[model samples]
Target: MEYYISNFSNVKKEEVKIKGSKGSFIQWLVTKDHGAHYAVRRFTLEPNGVIAPHVHKYQETVIILKGSTKVCVGREVKELHENDFIFIDSGVEHAFYNGMDPLEFICIIDYVDDMSIHPVDRSCI
Candidate 1:
């Protein structure tokens, strides 16, 4: 299979903007164009940064690489720390938020087209 390798530091970081949120997120990614059905990216949330509850047409997962975060699924909220992993089923409403310190994690999701992936926001909290 055709392939490529990249270090997170070698990738570009992007900002995350939830429709009605005050804080934002940033990411470093390894996309599917290199030959994979899914795309993975690292997300870093500034204090109070929130990823409004959103649904994925496809399943999604994230691993806490550093720092900690607060994740919400349905009505339950969970705290995640380094080495923790969170899995979200397709169509499930989920989101991430940071506490006092910045939080960071790596997210994995099905890859469709770069422009077609819009995580639909839903009722969170």
Candidate 2:
């Protein structure tokens, strides 16, 4: 068996440009290169940051690691804090907005060739 080990400090963070997203950064923790079926990523959002409503083909699981966030899943909106986790079904519209402080979270998703994100109407937010 093959394995890869990583530390957050040793990983590089990249600024990801998602439509309607502001102050968002991403760190790829585990990926296909690691021979994993799913990918693990860490995301950080600056204060008042927003990741607008969008949907993807793959299901996603998010775990809040720091600070607080306002989340919208479909028509329902809720506030989540550290240690909170949520599972989003494939094609379900969702978004994330940071609170007063920066927000951090871990996102896990299935590895797929098409992970395209489709924008959802903001009226639902």
Candidate 3:
């Protein structure tokens, strides 16, 4: 699929769950035309919102768009502002917290078809 960069913005948006949060997110593109085998999401987080600790079989990259957030990658914790980005490797525990007002960001994850591969165990902490 040859996608003109000009026509890329024509893609539709969809809502998705941000892992452990009650909040939802909007996904702009996750197709073959986007040059990604994974999903890409653009979403906002409300004040005090949280995306709980979890790990995946595929890597994920998050780019902060607005406001501030606290990100935990394994044992490390850092405060991230706009333009900040974080890369999480597969099987590493991580989560995010919106500590300073509402936060917006883009999260990209490589798509995996097997549900057995992305085993999310909430009881593991």
Candidate 4:
């Protein structure tokens, strides 16, 4: 297999708009320029924006590179600061939000076949 470095500057940042979401919320700069085993992505959460509770097909790990955030897993909510990290198991329902300023972070996840995100509600908690 070939190896290389992917830069955030080169990847297009895409907005993550959930179907039932009300406002402009999640944005992601994603890159899959390396091995297929995983994907590296940087996310920016805008104030008033949100990532509604959802389930993933692959396990995910996110590291707080900059800014603070509020993460919700099930009915539990916790505040996270810079340098913090969180792990979410596959099929686990969760969500996160940016505080006043733009919250930035890096997320690495097992390469998914289709990156299927199933939007869920509090009832799933």
lDDT of each: 0.73, 0.89, 0.69, 0.72
Off by over 4 Å in 1: 112-124
Give residue 125's lDDT in candidate 1 (0 to 100): 55
lDDT of 1 by residue, 72-105 (tens): 8767899999999988877667778788887778
Model 1 / residue 104 / CA error / Å: 1.1
What residue pairs clash in candidate 4, if any at all? none
Expressed as tens digits, the lDDT of each residue in 7-114 for candidate 4 is 667666677766544333333344364445677677777765577778888988989988887888757887889999999888877887666777788888887786
In model 4, the runs with Cα more than 4 Å from the true position are 20-33, 112-114, 123-125
Residue 39 error, candidate 3, Å: 2.5
TM-score of model 2 vs. true structure: 0.93
Quality of model 4 by C-alpha lDDT: 0.72
CA deviation > 4 Å runs, candidate 2? 123-125
Q: Candidate 3 lDDT, tens digit per residue, 1-125?
A: 55535333566544445456645356565645667576776767677777766666777799998898888777778888999998987788777777748888988877665422332444322
